[model samples]
Target: MPKQKGPIPITGTVKNTTYFSLNGQYYERRKSSLTAAVVATDPAFAASRRCNTVFATAVAIARTIYPQLPTHKRIAGAFGQLTGRVYQMVLKGMDADSIVTAILGE
Candidate 1:
């Protein structure tokens, strides 16, 4: 008899499923589920995904901050300018506090 081929078996437990060892070690396996809470719900992630919640909120914030830049292209340009300022600020300093504050922001 010939063996039938099928999809390869994977070793890890399924996502969102809790996996714990009889010993205390395997509990870390569920870290993604916990971390996904932050990654999945972050405002930047929502904005990048083009979610209405983020877009509308961003537009409102931008309008309040810069009433002259009512258009989307102008708002995008503002974002680019802000990003470039942030990049220059970080690039000018090499200290740990500066780098951390740059990446994490004040």
Candidate 2:
């Protein structure tokens, strides 16, 4: 993970590494070979599968509740913020059943 400091900035993949510029700075990272199918079906990606499942459930919950709310302005990232918090809770070992109960409970 070396920062690119040279005057001549190189961006894009070179062998096993990838270079990209962000906020006027350049950095390199290892290229990932993972794909959606691999993540879904691979035992090595069980945690990712769990997280994805939780995120999808969170999205569904939001969808059901969103239409019932009063028409109020929302922040640009509000949707992501809501779902991300749920995903974080999942990562922190919150039970899926408890999450569903909390969200859909009266």
Candidate 3:
């Protein structure tokens, strides 16, 4: 039998600094506290967000079906290809929901 090896030590820098202000007055640094429902219904983010949600759901379903595959790269490639086709369909004036349904088959 081969000799056992010990675990290697990990070395990294530890920074102790507060990069963000907790004060509500700093608009630029402030992050949105919007909930998922609010974001889903918001007109400004609706189209882009809907597309992202649909694409993500599709990829998740695909990953579930093929769990042995490296899903990150596969999902990324699927998203790119699906988005390209969806973009073309959108240019021809197709509704976002219909496009998502067609691509996802639901």
Candidate 4:
């Protein structure tokens, strides 16, 4: 992936900001207080949060399942690719459980 010139600018006020980068895409800064309200009232936000949770869990599981791998960079790169593919499959209406099971060879 190509590097960006700088951090992507986000519009609007946010509090308790945290930054996350996935597959070269940076997530928007989150406001902790407003996040609770948005999660409660927004279907899209809820789905996105659920998806992030699932991917985070899957990355942890993958680390355990493939513990013998060498190097932190390699492990992170592999999981990053795995997460992106799994996310795409999920977005395409595929079952995430099946995708993870297949990836884990379980």
Candidate 5:
């Protein structure tokens, strides 16, 4: 049974809880069990597949030119920004080589 310390309160872990808030609420977080295979093969995760495709394409381009980028404590931040912008372009069905040219000016 849940330990209810106040009116309209439900507390305590029952099962499969990933996260919970002390403000009289609970959240089930899927911290594990979601593998790449699950995302790729599950028909229910079609949206995830599409999103992943866009981001992957962006990262592929970013990686090819990453070593040429200036180094810094927050170097990954620039990579992230590049990936995000490229992701949007990919979602719009832009060509890969054109994306490289647009981002790198070459």
Candidate 6:
């Protein structure tokens, strides 16, 4: 990655409201949720209640940017999906927002 940019500033009240709604659900769904994904990827990322809070917040940000994703399917599974090599290559060089835009459209 070159230099990652700050999050795009959504425009107008409509966009703001839309983002709020999407973010709210994303936060709620994963608030108390934890997965082996974090544990395996970041050893410093301990599996604790606080970790879930941060994970939920991260999930919320991802969801707000990619509202089309199915909430249930967003969580990691017994067999990881996006964490795999294929998914990584497909999304290579793309920031999360760009990836969401490519996958889910505007």
Taking the candidates one at a time, how many backbone clashes does each contain?
0, 0, 0, 0, 0, 0
Highest-TM-score candidate: 2
Q: What is the C-alpha lDDT profile of model 5 across 1-106, one tens digit per residue?
A: 2433454434344565444455556444444667789978999999987877778888997776566555652354787887788888888888888877787673
Candidate 3 yields a Cα-based lDDT of 0.52
Instruction: Give each model a TM-score.
Output: 0.20, 0.55, 0.30, 0.36, 0.55, 0.24
lDDT of 4 by residue, 12-52 (tens): 44566555556656565545555567876787687778877
Number of clashing residue pairs, candidate 3: 0
Scored by lDDT, model 1 comes in at: 0.45
RMSD of 1: 15.6
Candidate 1 vs candidate 4: the lDDT winner is 4
Supply the TM-score for candidate 2.
Answer: 0.55
Q: Where's the lowest-lDDT run of ten residues in candidate 1?
A: 1-10
Writing each residue's lDDT as its tens digit, candidate 6 over 1-106 gives 1222345533223421322224323211112244578666765764664556544444544545443565765665512333342245333544556555655552
The regions of model 3 sitting more than 4 angstroms off are 1-76
Query: Distance (Å) between predicted and true CA of 87, model 3?
Result: 0.4
What is candidate 2's lDDT per residue for 21-95, written digit by digit as tens?
A: 998889999999977889778999898777677788777766654454345634577667656755676667776
Error of 2 at 56 (Å): 1.2
All candidates: CA RMSD (Å): 15.6, 5.1, 14.1, 9.4, 6.9, 18.6
Q: In angstroms, what RMSD does candidate 2 have relative to the true structure?
A: 5.1
* Cα misplacement distance, residue 51 of candidate 3 (Å): 16
Residue pairs with colliding backbones in model 2 are: none
